[model samples]
Target: MGGYLPETIVTNDDFTKMVDTSDAWIIERTGIRQRHKVAPGQRTSDLAVEAARVALAAAGRTPEDVDMVIVATTTPDMPFPSTASIVQQKLGTRPCAAFDVQAVCSGFVYALTVADGFVARGIARCVLVIGAEAMSQLLDYTDRGTCILFGDGAGAVVLEPVEGEGTSADRGILGFDLQCDGSKMDLLYVDGGVFEDSNRIGKIRMQGNQVFKHAVHKISEAAENAVIKSNLSMADVDWFIPHQANQRILNGVADKLGLDRDKVISTVAMHANTSAASIPLAWYIGVQDGRVKPGDLVLIEALGGGLTWGAAAIRL
Candidate 1:
């Protein structure tokens, strides 16, 4: 996996200058110290392309080698041409299947699941799955509840078919579970959109307390389900890479899974929440620091704005 964060950094003190918040108050509540933001005129596809190039290089592949591009993002560069298409064009990849999956924060896993189906069925040979977000552009900076919890970044991974024995001992993605509860959409969502407010873009709006409660429960449940589906147990998981939503929620899910806090990869303090990008970003950090490695059993999970939640088990 390869990850990219913009050059700009936004600190908690910066929020104090814009809203009725403080460094201490923000840290005490969200455990976020700083986040990165894109420069003016930088688009989400820009981040995605940079990350994708890194991933393709790391995988020893060229743009023409990719047979499909699936971008998981809520903040698309445009409504007509999907961000995946923009990324493909920017990367100079050949004509191939390109699309976007908008399960909000659960997007990466959702896209991965979709890609798994294609590769498993021999429909695509090589696929680029990216979770990129320009979340800062969607933030209502005045709303400390939402603004402080997001950052802009992109992460990408290349998935190719790895023949296995059809067992949990498989080399690649072993199993996954995707879920959503539309009834709880109001718990976390944007206030405006193309169809909702005269084609106006909206800012993030969330009910912190309620989303926190559900995140802990739903994220844990989906993770456990994925492990079981893979014919494995939590004890078999070497690393717990949950979404970087909040430190409190991350710890809560780890506790519920009985996972050692040290085994959980967390980047929320520095990266805050990158929505769909969180898992791959955190995974990239772990790999760079020598924590995550090939053949390690990993559990991934996330909860997003659609009230969507999902998990996947893989042997990386």
Candidate 2:
């Protein structure tokens, strides 16, 4: 796993200067101290390429060796050619199956789930899975409740098929569950889309209290289903990596599962909520710090814009 955070630092103190918020008020509510932002003219692909290069190198594989590239991002460079294509070209990889998956924040897991299907069926050999987001670009800086909770960053992981006897002991994705409840879309979303507005771009609008009301129950249930599908119990999970939406949400899910709080990997304090990038970014931190190791049973989960939520079990 690999991760990248832009150079520009936007701290809670910075928000006080631009919005009707203070450092103490922000920290007391979200547990976020600071976040990174991309420079002007730096596209989403730039972050994706940076993270992908490092991940490919760490995995000891060349771009030419990859069979597919799946980028999970809500903020793509364009609506036409997927950012995955740009990432493939910049990495000097051959023309292969490349595309994007946008389940909002649940994207990385969705992309990983899709890639695992291809590898399991012998459709691809090595796949590059990336969750890159410039969520700051989508926020209304004046909206402290939303703007203060996002940052710009990217994370990538290289997944290859590992033969197994069809058990929870498998090395790759053992099991996964994907779901969406569009009825609750108003809880969190952007105000515009391709056809909704002539501007074609819009700032994010979130009903914090409403979203919070629904998150814990759906997220906890998804986690439980994934673990049971993998034929394992919560006690068997060595690590808990939840989408870095909020510290409160992370703790809520852990408590629901009766899992140790220390077992959870979190980067929300420094990275804030990088949306789809949060899970992989948190996982990369664990890998680097020696908390996450090979053969560890890991539980991954997220809740995103579509009111989409999912979970997957992996033996990494």
Candidate 3:
């Protein structure tokens, strides 16, 4: 369900030395125990490869059988070669179309939508979609407000075509809704980029309160949109695999939607906001732990930088 975190754990104390923050402060605001950071020299592609391999094995498929690779990462190894292409080569996949999707935290769902379209159109048999991030690379470790909110990790899923009556009961993707508002881009974004900074990525800047306010509303709306698109009522959802941002945000969204708290799968306490990697990682963990099962109706929702948000309804 999820890729392994590096053995080393970085505590808030470790960050206290690097940033102006304390463990008590971080714990009080965000329920993060610790987070995993890739060693220097590790790249997003590396994480994607491992996650993709695990997902492929989980789905009982070989690399050669995969017909597509979609990587969702704002942090890529390089700008020249797409991370998905790098993953494709690493997995030894042949004759497959590979690319990247960038929707910040919602990138996984966006990438999944692309893969779903390919499968539905009979263009691909099996697609490997990965959400990998090295947010540590983009973090301003000295900034207390944002530095403690991010971590590095990756998660993946294997999508395969299935024949069924065209209905919500089909054992695959049923519905999805994606949205973006550039006017709110300043709510959470990096300050510098290509044209201005010699193509070097910049440090992340976030208005925590502003982002928090919109996230709760938009995520709930996306969740409801997905459920309604599937022609299902909220009561029919078996689980909600929400983006693991903060416990408060998750709880707020669940409460707003009147969703059962027990049905929400969360990994924020352990993952510490892995951006695009959150939902897939949570889904993987839930399924691997027997919390999610075949025939379960799973709803996923996410919001992040770029003010992008989306949701997907899938019948497991």
Candidate 4:
């Protein structure tokens, strides 16, 4: 696993001058003390390539060893020549399948699930799954509601096939439950796109209350389905690494699942919400801090724009 956070640190206290918010209010509401931002000229793929390098190194492999690349991100370097392809070029990987998955915040898990299937089918042996975003580019800094909730960061994991009997007892990517309800996509979205008059990326907009309501239920439902699919239950899960959307959503899901607070891997306090980058970023932190380790039963859940929500189980 690997993660990369930009060097520019923006604290809630710093926002006092830029927006109508206080340190206490931000913390009490979102549990985010600070967030990172990319400097001028840095693109999403820039952060992504750095993250991919670290992930490949941690796995004790080189870019040439990569058989496929899948990037999960909402903010791509551009709309064409997929971010995955750009990463491949920077990483110097050989020609192989490369693409991007844009499931918003649930992207990493979605990409991980896809890689798992590819390796399982013997189509690829070593696949790099990355969740990266330069979300600061899309934030309206004056909009306190959305600006305070996002940060710039990237996380990656290299998935390799571990031959098994093809059962729930597998060592990697044990089970998955993914779902999306697009009927109400308006609750959280950006205000600009290709057809928009603004050449720049659009700022984020969100209905906090509506998103909160769906978050608790969808997150819990995904986690429950994932655990069941793994032939296990909440009691069997050793860790819950959820998207770092908000402290309240994380806590609510934990309470609903009857899981201990300590067992949850949360990075929102420091990393804020890096959209799709949240999961692997949190997972990397958990591993480094010794909270998650080999043979651990890890459950990851996320709810993102597109009203997408899902869960993935892995026996590390």
Query: Whose lDDT is greatest here?
Result: 1
User: lDDT tens digits, residues 1-316, model 3?
Assistant: 4474555578888988887788888988988878888888888998999988898888899899998999999898888589999989888998779999999999999999999999999998999999999888899877889889888899999999888999989999899999999999999988877756876669999999999999999999998999999999889999999999998899899999999999999888878988888889899999889999999999999998889999999999
What TM value does model 4 have?
0.98
The window of 10 residues in a row where model 3 has the poorest summed lDDT is 1-10
The per-residue C-alpha lDDT of model 3 at residue 283 equals: 92
For residues 147-204, what per-residue lDDT tens digits would candidate 2 score against the true structure? Answer: 9999999999999977788788879898889999999998899998787887657999
| Candidate 3 wrongly placed segments (more than 4 Å) | 199-201
Model 3, total clashes: 1
Overall local distance difference test of candidate 3 = 0.89
Q: Model 4: per-residue lDDT, tens digit, 141-182?
A: 898998899999999999998868776666998889999999
The alpha-carbon lDDT assigned to residue 295 of candidate 1 equals: 93
lDDT of 4: 0.92
Off by over 4 Å in 1: none
Candidates in order: C-alpha RMSD to true structure: 0.9, 0.9, 1.2, 1.0
**Candidate lDDT values, in order:** 0.94, 0.92, 0.89, 0.92
TM-score per candidate: 0.98, 0.98, 0.97, 0.98
